[model samples]
Target: MVMRVVVIRVKILETNQQVELDVKSTTVRELLLRLGLTLSEHIVFKNGEVITEDDIVEDNSEVVVFTVKSGG
Candidate 1:
């Protein structure tokens, strides 16, 4: 059996905290959930474009997740 490797880049907040995760999921939501990330108000961008939770990612794709902050 051959396994495909998917490289996903994750960026949290406004900082430069970047991390790479290897997964074999077809959708972004599946990858996030697998990485133990709970989707809330955080915005996710794939290759600079905003993507939904159901967005499917290809192999060696870069995914950036930013947490949006709101204040009173």
Candidate 2:
């Protein structure tokens, strides 16, 4: 028997780029680290809902990353 790994699609709104991660599952923090993004610098959204770094993101799911910006 063989197991199949589904890819997770991550779309970065700031960079306008999309990347695929091959894994069974991953945490938002891990995903950010893999993409070289900082938790404080970026915000993650899964299925249009904001997710925390501790949140678990499964494979084959679409995620969006937005750069955090502030002006004062």
Judging by lDDT against the true structure, name the best candidate. 2
TM-score of 2: 0.88
Give candidate 1's error at residue 36 in angstroms.
Answer: 2.9
> What is the lDDT of every predicted structure here?
0.72, 0.92
RMSD in angstroms between candidate 2 and the native structure over all alpha carbons:
2.3
TM-scores for all candidates: the values are: 0.67, 0.88
lDDT of 2 by residue, 16-57 (tens): 999999877999999999999999989899989999999999
Predicted structure with the largest TM-score when compared to the true one: 2
- Each candidate's number of clashing pairs is 0, 0
| lDDT at position 16, candidate 1 | 67
Model 1: weakest 10-residue lDDT segment is: 4-13
- Model 2: which residue pairs collide? none
Q: Which ten residues in a row are the worst by lDDT in model 2?
A: 63-72
What is candidate 1's lDDT per residue for 1-72, written digit by digit as tens? 866555666776556677776764458677667656677756789878999988887667787877676753
